[model samples]
Target: MSVAHLIGKAGKPYTVEVEKCHIRQFAQAIGDTNPLYSDEEFAKKTVHGGIIAPPTFPIAMSEESDEDLDLGLEYSRMLHGEQRFIYTRPIRPGDVLTCQLKVTDVYEREGKNGTMEFIVMDTEMTDAAGAHVVTSRTNIIYRSVSANA
Candidate 1:
């Protein structure tokens, strides 16, 4: 099955409630000790006015079920190629975000080892007030098994 036909396919929307503890944990796990991510008092003095999640914290927000939209790539041959995020505003504790994933583009290219299929997707995160918060673009590459072997 050609996954090229799956472009524009979107998965079910999921919501994630931002929590102070989760934000702090993610910051700590990433070796970041920024006050904005942990100290409410310190953050209160900042423009954000409260604790906010780190920039990369949205990486932790995801839908567990990708079964809704399958690309039909060999699981073992798939690799994460790249990821980029565009944020409208910083994520803050107590914010409820709705996220939806869609396949934006699909293409193929010849690589050093073989022909690889690149699957590009965009996940848009919107706040409870129906405002865009961030959009994360993910590129997934699948190398041809026959060419590699």
Candidate 2:
């Protein structure tokens, strides 16, 4: 199946109330020992005046069900190409975040082995008050296993 057909497709909307534990757990999962994500006392002393989620913590909150973002390609043969995040402000506890995902682009280019397909998707996040919080762009690469074999 051609990934081009997926361009313009929209995914399920994801929302979550970011909590202190959520930030701390995300930091721990990524092995980030930053006090801003864990030590409330220390974070309170910082310029933020409170603890905050890691820059990439939104990834944990952006969830898409099977009904969305199904590229109809070989799942095992796919690879994450890249991830970029732009943040307006630090995500802190008590903030509710909502994300809308969409397939922004798809293209093909020659790889070391052969032609490869690239799928580009984006998630725009907003706070409960409808303020833009962050925007993430994700790139996924897919290749056929038959070619590798």
Q: Tell me the number of clashing residue pairs for each predicted model.
A: 0, 0
Give the Å error, residue 127, model 2.
Answer: 0.5
Assess the local accuracy of residue 95 in candidate 1 as a C-alpha lDDT between 0 and 100. 87
TM-score of 2: 0.87
Q: Rate the local accuracy (lDDT) of all candidates.
A: 0.83, 0.83
Once fitted onto the true fold, the runs of candidate 2 whose alpha carbons sit more than 4 angstroms away are: 64-68
lDDT of 1: 0.83
- Tens digit of lDDT per residue, candidate 1, span 1-149? 35688799888888888888988888889899889888889999999888888887777875433455666667887788998889999888888999988999999998787677889988899999999999888888877877557
- For model 1 the local lDDT of residue 132 reads 98
Q: Positional deviation of 145 in candidate 2, in angstroms?
A: 4.2
Candidate with best TM-score: 1
TM-score to native of every candidate shown: 0.89, 0.87
